[model samples]
Target: MVASLLSARGLNKQFHSGNQPVSVLSNLSLSLEQGESLALTGRSGSGKSTLISILCGLEQPDSGRLTVLGEAFDGDAGRQTEARWASLRRQQIGVVFQEANLMPALSLLDNVRLRVRLAGQDEDGCRDWLERLGIGELAARYPDQVSGGQRQRAALAMVFAMKPALILADEPTGSLDRHTAEDVTGQLFDLQARYGCGLILATHDIELATRCNHHLDLGHQPEA
Candidate 1:
């Protein structure tokens, strides 16, 4: 049988606003296989980001079981150590945020190199990734010197350079213009397919969600 890349069961999360507790995620569960893409679609504040955070080990669910690349975490077992989660993120997961994902101090090439090095990948090919993403000319520029689209391209180069087993992109193109968003999305899907990695993209764009192998709407009823 083909092994799953990621899995979650009975996931539940809640937060407090003043004296009231609001449920963010309730009995949420899903899975992703290698080379498969799952688009998570939901309205804003519908637990999309929260789910991504939990999947990437950035936050713990109040109750659930999550397994990623053979690493398992259950509510009964408590949260994993910060060091452990950090290591997992550094080596196995690549996250692309809407903005501020790049290191402001480093040049674009250096940022990609750093991520590649962290994943035990060769740093020499970092430039190749940028070139593939059509940002080779901006390799030496700082994040602030580039346009939003170029910065996002650099982010993609960094993520792809890391050679992560799984990628979690939360509204990766949310801040870009429609044309720019489409370009970035195309490159993202192409590289994801070429790398044979698992991807979980959280966004409200229905057209974008339809491109993925599967789509899960968090606004709908959670599986029993």
Candidate 2:
């Protein structure tokens, strides 16, 4: 059996709006093994983004627990130390977001190779990933210089170059047209399979969710 790469138990999150508390996630539980792909589907404002953030250790839940790649996170100073290992997670974990979120100052190639530079690896190989993703020609271009689909594609290439063990994506194709979205989505799944990384994508796109091996529908659950 493939080893479990990530696990969450009783995952809960809440926020306070003025005098009242708004619950975001309640006892949400999930697990992912190496090379697995899970798609999260839900309506808007259903705590999907909150859950994703918590899973990535970007936000702390009011209560609950999470473990990633065998290490536990408690949201304490010790866990802060552990979370500093987020760099390690970044090195080994790819993240694709709806906006592409590339820096305006860097060229496409420079953006993709930035992680490589940070890890002291050869940046030349970034060219191959760009070529594979069919964004090679755009390498010389800046983020604002490209179309939305192209920018997202460039972002994927950047994360792909990392060869992460797990990938957490939130509506990666949300900004693209249908055809372009499908194109980018196909490339992402292909790379995920090729690299044997766990993929957990949060999206409301049914077509996108259908492409994954497994699906988790957050819309059916009661609001937290």
Candidate 3:
């Protein structure tokens, strides 16, 4: 078997909602290898987003172990981890959030080119990704000027341009119309295959999950 590019062992996350402790993920474990794609499905409040947050290092687990490319996730050294993850994510991990999350002031090209700049990548890499994602024509348009579908496409371009090792998307199509959602999802998978990036997506769409290599029902866990 191929080595896993990312892994989580004994993953658990808990939060305080008033005086009660809400356990989100309990004893959950998952792994993904390069070029693999897995879809995670769970109903609302099933900890799907929480899990994604932890995996992306956006939030720390109360207790668990996370390893990316053999390196541990160190929240204590988050600045360092962010820098390293930012670099690795730039080189390997692509993320597509539910919202396009574009800056209204920036042009589509600049928005897509943001990570390339952060990663210190070259213009060729940025331009190539924009073209591949079918947004080269709108490169000069500002985010606010574009349609919702176009904005999502631009966001995908930005993430793809990073050429990350893994791609983590949280309900990337949730806000789109069926047609646009399908288009975005199609592009996401196409890029995943093309780039050989491991994909771990948290989605409520069952049909989307079926298209992946493996599917897991996170809501079925005994406790959450």
Candidate 4:
């Protein structure tokens, strides 16, 4: 049998509010295969972003096991595993958090080119990716020059240019208008399908969530 592209088992995470502990994710388990997509839906504070952070190794779960692209990490990964996760992020994992983390000094096009170069992908297609996302005209603009939604699209363009094997998108369309959101979302799925990459999308948009192959609702989490 083929191993999953990403897997998490018995994951648990919590935070402390000065003294009281607040449970976030409780014994969550999930598996994702290449070419599959998983949607995470819940109200705010329902652990959507938390889950995304954990999946990409930005934040570690209090206790659990996580495997991505064949690299395994225990919940208490700490700083020792950052290099491994960083390598995967540069070449195999693409993350699009709500905040478009674009460099202040780089033009949109340069951001995409940088990502492609880091991933060892051809930079020639960077502009094409931006065009497909409807942001080609703004390629020369800095992040501050564009609207929030446009910056988000630019971020998406960077991710696509990298052609990562796995994508973690947290409200990728949150900043766009309805029409722009539709256009961006279409491109997101199209590229993901063409590349056969695994996707884990965290969104409050029911319509967007329905597009994924699997759905998990944190509001009604299973008992651990």
Writing each residue's lDDT as its tens digit, candidate 4 over 1-224 gives 54489999999999998999999999999999989999999999999999999998888898999999999998545566998988998998999987788998999999999888999999999999889888899999999999888888888899978988899999988877889778778888998999888899999998888999999998889989
- Candidate topping lDDT: 1
Clashing residue pairs, backbone N/CA/C < 3 A, model 3: 92-164, 92-165, 93-164, 93-165
Per-residue error (Å), model 3, residue 61: 0.6
- After TM-score superposition, the amount by which residue 125's alpha carbon in candidate 3 deviates from its true location, in angstroms, is 3.6
Candidate 2 deviates by what RMSD? Answer: 1.9
Model 2, position 15: C-alpha lDDT score: 90
Roughly what TM-score does model 4 have, to 2 decimal places?
A: 0.94
Any residue pairs clashing in model 1, and if so which?
A: none
| lDDT (0 to 1) per candidate | 0.91, 0.83, 0.82, 0.90
lDDT of 2 at 36: 92
Residue 145 error, candidate 2, Å: 1.1
Please provide, for model 1 over 1-224, each residue's C-alpha lDDT reduced to its tens digit, 9 standing for 90 to 100: 56699999989999999999999899988999999999999899999999999998888899989888888887543335556678889998999999848889999999999888888888989999999999999999999999999999999999989999999999999999999999999999999999999999999999999999999999895554
In candidate 3, which residue ranges exceed 4 Å CA deviation? 74-83, 222-224
lDDT: worst 10-residue window of model 3: 74-83
Residue 148 in model 1: lDDT: 96
Total backbone collisions for each predicted model: 0, 0, 4, 0
Model 2 residue 161 lDDT?
Answer: 87
Task: State TM-scores per candidate.
Answer: 0.96, 0.93, 0.92, 0.94
- Rank order by lDDT, top first? 1, 4, 2, 3
lDDT (0-100) at residue 110 of candidate 2? 90
How would the candidate models be sorted by TM-score, starting from the highest?
1, 4, 2, 3
